[model samples]
Target: MGAPESLSLLNPARHAGGVFVNGEWQRPRGGSRVVTEPATGLELAASAVANAEDMREAIAQAHAAQRAWAATNPRERAAVLLRAAEGLQAHFDELALAIARETGGILAKGQHEVREAIVICQIAAGLPLQAQGQVLPATPGRLSIARRVPHGVIGVISPFNFPLILGIRSVAPALALGNAVVLKPDTRTPVTGGAIMAEIFQRAGLPSGLLQMLPGDAEAGEALVTDSRVPMIAFTGSPAVGRRIGELAGRHLKKVSLELGGANNLVILDDADLDAAASAAAFGAWFHQGQICMASNRVLVHEKIADALKARLVAKAGYLPVGDGASGQVALGPMIDNKQLQRFNALVHETVAQGATLEAGGSHTGLCYQPTVLSGVKPGMRSFDDEPFGPLVNLVTFSTDDEAVALANNSQGGLSAAVISHDVGRALALGERLNAGMVHINDQTVNDECTNPFGGPGLGGNGSAVGGPADIDEYTRWQWLTVKAALPAFPF
Candidate 1:
């Protein structure tokens, strides 16, 4: 049996309901939005929605708190992050269940996200210790040095897909660099993702007002972004919105980081192992219903093995279980909402009309779209350039390696690409020609590590890196200093 659709049907108080401001929960000034269980259309909770006033208060609180937070010892701040990781592990089951309910995520996926979230916390904890600086080599009777410092208040706007992981990754890194965060999580799953982080940080003994979680729709995000108090923004969503943010933040000469979705692709060379390639495709194309920004929009296969790869993918997609996430028995779960499901179906229909043949599931029963595979996909098709961001994936064949690389690079840069080949030399050489911020060899496109420099070129948003020890550079500002004991002759 699956879990009930509504938290009201269970222990209502357990839902971490309300907006988090100044290290505390507050009633929304603009009312609340119903958070529905996508798998069943059941009301999970009424997440508090923030209005302009609420957003202002949160930003003000964050700005005020940032000073104290920056003044605190970096090592002590790191200690808090490490403790928060342990606390997250202790509440792992509860967090996983909340993630499944909030996002309609399959149990295994919810568990996987929680595990990734914890790892992000752990990595963030160690980052503060690795902050680096350099001393200048050329100077007489003087000292010259450069060091990184916090960017003060930062506004983090995260999307619904993998909310817990995405939300925390942004928040943890900013905090590690001694900055305060005013986070606006996707309204759909705020409590499970945003509010939960506030809870853990509070329990971890983080200072009050250091981090605020505001749960609301796009209006709230806009208010947070356009505000002058927030000098920086870290956004993860579509390129359209990222452009708007870039324009606004640029107007103010403010710093911003974006991780927008892209039309990603992968290539399968003829010599690759059939079963291994097939498994990689299934995982990359269908995990979390293919909502990842790095999910494959199209796959280029060597013509020699195209037929075999297509058959394997069809068998895998056709055999995969699909149902409500709470059942813990299905491999695939529901789309976030009906609109995405509609788009998924429309894209498939249009692609088929454009001459691609459907080899597996393409329709839907409510929000649960059957994993779909389409062959003979061409560049001009709606499905070719459009990133459906669902379980639907396309297969296109290439006769030569140059053609495959061309197809992969054909997109207007945003995400990543993968090259699967038995020849390491060939794979590495081909990877060099791909246009992306990240590339994988003999691997899938849908991949991330907590300590990697993740983000891409094109419309994927630039000017920041949100992962690894390198994150200190993005979340903080750098200053060069020079000191002289006495006046020296001017060379100017």
Candidate 2:
């Protein structure tokens, strides 16, 4: 297909009027907020900043809509999601362009994200039937079955990176399971998220208020989560924010799923292919400017291959084309905003001050930070301990499998890890010992499959996304149903 026509930039106030609530497009009572493109600092769109009243109204609508939707059979709900997926695919190009422009992701990457969103929607559509529970043996003349049920109104707060895909992935599963959703897209890239979801739901004939999109900042998100009407919350963002949300949800005794930040690690074994490993590491470290929650931030190479891997990894980083995300050939995009850029720069400088050598690409152009590699990195450096959340990777060398495994496990954040090794036995053994939620053998650890569970343990945070069946299961609660024959008249 040819490139999709770009969306005409609209004034933030005017765009904010499009926020969907109660089956109608309307503006927030508190007014609107402007969204700017990270790459050019151009105003991309404006979104309605929802207030306390808006949150209440949305919650009420969701509660009412969720009851009706939950009453609808799973088969019908599945059909709606399937239809939504089809609609998304039909308009992939349009959706992709909006995402690229709004989120500062390369056009190709945006297109891929759009496609992935469709896939997630399609997979989630099948969740209705797949959510079937088991029939357990019971007493004589009694039948007991455990079934999964939705958590009424669910609140979803998505991050700026992978806005389209992650939002859809979370929302689709919740909607498919017969729960109403209140989505708060990231303040920086709300246009693409709100637009794509509005388009798909409009086509799917979804009930009014079943899926509401409120695009704004932290205040808006706080309003949604703390509101008593919302029974469940799904958040993907920084750990600090996730912790706050968790604390709030805990007070209410509400259910919450959080996919927080990561300082993901990658181990390069002595037997690995230096060229391929370097290339994969570069991509894994720099994709989406390393804004991804699961982006590999630390590299542990066997001393035998450390020098060769570092040389090739640095060289590969230099080849990454960085520029306007709208440019099709650009592989690296700018950070989401100036704040993120500054934070990234600070981490790099701090790591260097701590004795880490800058291997390549530490310069910045506006929100764009060059794909950077730092060697001789030791523990205690900011980049080594904290998630850079930018295009930065720290490299260190290990002497043995035990030491490498120890180093990998040293981080409090155990989100995900990649081990590049030719020896399958050793890889498997290491995988078993590693404490991450997922491990990739001979590959970078950014692999996200719709059917596989995604999320990390410990400080990486607890919660999973898009693990096909696991996602469906996570969004629902189980109830046991027992049917028993009447007692004998004598007993009565």
Per-residue lDDT of candidate 2, residues 68-120 (tens digit):
89989888888888888777777777667777888888898788887888788
lDDT of each: 0.84, 0.81
- Of candidate 1, the 10-residue stretch with the lowest lDDT total is 1-10
Model 2 CA deviation exceeding 4 Å by range: 2-17, 463-466, 485-492
Cα displacement (angstroms), candidate 1, residue 73, comes to 1.1
RMSD of each: 3.2, 2.4
Among these predictions, the greatest lDDT belongs to: 1
Give the per-residue Cα lDDT of candidate 1 at 224. Answer: 87
What is the Å distance of residue 292 in model 2 from its true position?
A: 0.7
Tens digits of lDDT, candidate 1, 1-492: 232344221234543357888876778797887789998898888777888899999999889889988888879999999988877777777778778877877987788877888898888888778745788875678899887878899999888888988889889988987899998988888876687788888888889998998887778888888899888999998888889888888988789898887767788999999999999988888888988888877788999999999999999988899889877988889999888788778989989988999999988888988999999998889888877789977998999989988887777785778989999899899988988878899999988888898888876567356788558878888888888898888999
